[model samples]
Structures are given as C-alpha cells and as structure tokens.
Target chain A: TQLLEQSPQFLSIQEGENLTVYCNSSSVFSSLQWYRQEPGEGPVLLVTVVTGGEVKKLKRLTFQFGDARKDSSLHITAAQPGDTGLYLCAGVKNSGGSNYKLTFGKGTLLTVNP
Target chain B: DAGITQSPRHKVTETGTPVTLRCHQTENHRYMYWYRQDPGHGLRLIHYSYGVKDTDKGEVSDGYSVSRSKTEDFLLTLESATSSQTSVYFCAIGNTGSPDTQYFGPGTRLTVL
Candidate 1:
C-alpha cells in the first residue's frame, strides 16, 4: 500500500502569516489533489496537480507537485481566520491499475487567529 | 456543490445493534463511495458502487456492507455496531468521465457506545 506522509500535523499562526504544508511519499503518483475540510463538513477539493513540477494557484493558495511526483506542497499567503481548516493530500499511485482509488495523508490542521 | 444528502446526520447506538445510513444524490453520477474519517487516520474508504447493483469492497470493508439499488441512492449498513466503528461517515459521488474529482455530502456522525 502507498502512503502519503504529511508534516506539521497542527499549526497555529496569527492572521497575515504565511505557511506551507508538505506531503511526501516514497512511491510516485500519477496525480495528487489537495482538499480542505471545515468542522462538521466533508472535505472540499482545493486543487489537483497531475504533472511533475506542476503548480496551480487559487486565490491566496498555491499548490505544487514535486519534480519526482512523489511529493507535493501547499502554500498559503497571508493566511486568514477563514482559512483555518484541515488540509488533506491525496494521491493516485503510478502503478495502480485504476485511477479512482486514492491514498490519503493524515492531514494538517491549521488555525489562523485574527 | 454536489446534490448529495445523507440521512440520519447523527446517530447513537449501542454495541451489537444494527445501524443503517442512507445516501441520496441528485447528480446522477455513475460512481458513489463511502468513507470513514477518524482522528489521525485521515479518510479510509469503506465501499463503493460503480452502478446500480454493482459494488466493491474498499480497504476497510470488514463489518460494513453497502447496496446500491438505484442511480441516486446508496445505503451502508453495519450488522453489529462496535465502539471501534464509531466515526464520521461521508458519502461521495463521482462522474464516470472524471473519477478523480468527487463531491461529498455533509456527512453522518455515528457513535457506538
């Protein structure tokens, strides 16, 4: 089974601070996706990176896929209280016959205080 | 947002009792998935359905069963509840063309005491 390891399980910062969360794995992935979930709600997809060294930006959030496709990262610029939530990284293994199944990381819980 | 709804948004049951959670979707997606979220464990897939009357077990299928009788409805059942099974359950719908992106329902919080 493939595993994605996320770093800094818990993070707390004042509003306007910049933060980056990393997800690493030994196995290469065909695709990687980022999701943010608020309390009492299911996860919502933030972005998806399919190519190595790919980067995508959504408003104040930026996501990058590693050159080796074995890791990914999410960077938040000027974090706000509204951005506080659980961030999750999920990946589809390169060798998996099916693309529907995904391996997920534990997640990073971010709290931005105003 | 996806047109997905889960019934019994919250449920509390005793050990050995049976419990069932219903998922309804209006998107008419071809794929539906069931997942359980636990602290520090992330989200684990319990089961999924490819089409009506067609389902498959996921990584954590033990003690859980799923049935899909219609395109818009999927059901998950627990034969005998256990404290270990207590967790937040989420239902997701996926399009046949784009399986990677799935839309999730609000979720159901189940507590087995």
Candidate 2:
C-alpha cells in the first residue's frame, strides 16, 4: 500500500476555474513537498511544508499542511493551461539508521482547457 | 536540475541482459538516490548513496544494485534484467538544507523485452 494517497486521479477543467488536490496519509511525516511534472520532464519541487498547520503560497497556488502533519492540500486559483501537468505530493519519513525516505502519492493528473 | 544528468535517456534490452545506468551530479550533494516510476505505483526507491562507497538498498531493491565510487557519480545496475524491470528511472540529489529538498534529473526510460 502507498503511504500517501491523492485524489482525484484525473481532473479536467476549463481555464479560470479553481480546483484542489489532496494528499492524505495515516502516518505522520517530518515534511511534505509538492511537485509538478510536464510531459517530458522530471518533477520539479513547487513547495515544501514542515510545521504542522503551515501554509504556503506560490503565485496562484496555495499549499496547506494539516495540523497533524499527515495530510496536505494544493489549491489552484484560476487555473491556467500551463498548469496542465502531473501533481505529486511526497512525505519525508525517517527510515531509521540516519536515513530518510520519501513516500510519494500516485499523483493527480490535471488538465486545464483554454 | 541542480547540474544532475543521466546518461542514455532511453534504452531497450532483452531479458537476462545486464544493464547499467549512470547519474552524475556537479553540485557535490552528499546524498544521491535512484527511483523507478511506474503507472499507479508512483516512484519507488531502488537504492541510494550517502557518500563515496556508502550505499544502501531502498524499498524496491530486488534485482538492482548501486555503486558510488566517487562523490560525483552514482550508478545503478541490473544484475539480470527482466521484463518487470522496465520503467522510468530517475536520479536525485539533496539533503543540503533543512527539511531536505531534492532535485531530479531528466528520467531514463528503460524497456526490457
């Protein structure tokens, strides 16, 4: 089973619409990160949240971390076509022995029509 | 980015063949990782390195091995490739600051027939 779960698996909306992507987990994590990936490129870090109940904003996108550090959400305001990509959320968890591993969600594939 | 590069972005091999993929980073980050991305599975880590000659297995390490002979290069090898081993491979480097952020190289697509 995946440590992180994201929904909905696929979303398509028109430009100027608003949407939210969620990542939930039963296990608590040290940090949560959001990444966006285009068709032919690797995923790029969009934002990282550490503190519980922390919130971050990058332009039209807003990211919120749950108070328990077990969940996170990404909200896009007035989504654009350029935002069409795969949105992934990962949680950082200690694997013991001075090592940390990232557990990633399956990702939400979003498409915005212009 | 972060000066990370993967060689032979695409490869096709037959079952039972041995294959090696290379990842080189110019940023001199202390940690390097290898992950395989597949549909519905997201990215599953195969192996990682903490420093020169210091490597460890990750969640899905079967049929795979890694070597870090130097600070700049980390290599992932398939001892005997199988059809199930075909997937997109990504290399990442990080752990530079608080919370540990990673930067990935363009992925390599591998196909085993």
Candidate 3:
C-alpha cells in the first residue's frame, strides 16, 4: 500500500486555470514536503510543512498541512505552462533523531497548456 | 555546500550484466540515499546510509544492494541487471539532525535491455 496517496494522477489544463492536488495518508507525519520534477532531472523541493494545520504559500502555489497531520494539499493559482511537470508529496516521520526516511507519493503529473 | 553528483548520466546494458551507479557528495552530510523513479510508481527508496558502512534497505530493496564505504560516496549495484530495473536513479544528501531537506543529484538513467 502507498503510505502517501496523491490524487489526480494526471492533469492537463489551459493557462490561467486554477487547480488543486491532494495528498492523503492514514499515518501521521512529522513533516510533509512538496517537490516538482521535470524530465531528465530529479525532484526539486518546493516546500515543507512541519506543523499540523499549517499553510504555506510560494507565489502561485499554496500548500496546506492537514489539522490531523495525515494529509496535505497543493493549490496552484493561475497556472502557467511553466508549471508543467510532476508534483510529488513526501512525508517524514519523527524518528527522534534527524535520520528519517521520506515516503513519497506516486505524484501528480500536471500539464498546463499555453 | 549541498552538492550531490551522480555519475554515468546515461547507460544502457544487456540483461545479466552488472551495473553500478555512484553518488558522490561534497556536503559531507553523513547521510546518503539512493532512490529509483519509475512511471506511475513515484520515487521509491532503494537504500540509505546513515554513515559509512552502515546501510539500510527501503521499500523496494529486492534485486538491489548498496555500499557506502566513505562519507562522500555511496554506490548502488545491480548484480544482474534486468529490464525491470531500468529506471532513473537519484542520489540525495542531507544532514540528519536538521530539517532533513534532502538535496538531489541530477540523476542517472540506466536502461537494461
């Protein structure tokens, strides 16, 4: 089973459209992160939410951490073709120490048509 | 500096052949990881090392092995390459005690025919 499940496995929309992606899990996490991956490259960290019920915004993208710490969401405002790529959500458990492995979601492949 | 580099950006090998991908870091972060990316499967952790010579398995550890003999080098080896193992491999380095935001390498595309 996937510890972190991302919805809308694939998405394609015209520029200026708004979209939201969801990441859910039954397990609580110490923190959750969002990443964007382009072809021939590794996933790049977009943001990390450490507190439950926390919300963070990165210009056109807004991220929310669930109050229960079991889920998160990413919303893109006025999406652009530059947003075309795979968006991934990963969760980290509190391992007491700094050494913890991140569980990744299959990711949502977003295509913003120009 | 959190600079992570993976060698052999692209490779193609036949089945039953041995393949090794190397991850080198200048961060000296004491933690290194190998992950494989496959279509519709996301990025799955293959192996991770907390320190030199101390490695652990991840969700998909079968048919793969790893070694970290030094702080800056971690190696992932496929004893007998198979088509199923063909995927883009990434290396990451991070400090264990901080926020643990991992820095990833460009990636190595390995194709086993």
| DockQ, cand. 3 | 0.76
Candidate 3's C-alpha runs over 4 A off are: none
- The alpha-carbon lDDT assigned to residue B101 of candidate 1 equals 85
lDDT of each: 0.93, 0.92, 0.92
Local lDDT at B43 for model 3? 92
Name the top DockQ candidate: 3
* Each candidate structure's count of clashing pairs: 0, 0, 1
Model 3, span A49-86: residue lDDT tens: 98999999999999999999999999999999999999
Given candidate 1, what's the lDDT at residue A13? 99
Q: Which ranges of candidate 1 are over 4 A from the true structure?
A: A93-99
Per-model TM-score of chain A alone? 0.94, 0.95, 0.96
True contacts kept of each: 0.58, 0.47, 0.72
Model 1 gets an lDDT of 0.93
lDDT of 3 by residue, B30-96 (tens): 8888999998889999998889998988889999999988899999999999999999999998885
The better candidate by TM-score, 1 or 3, is 1
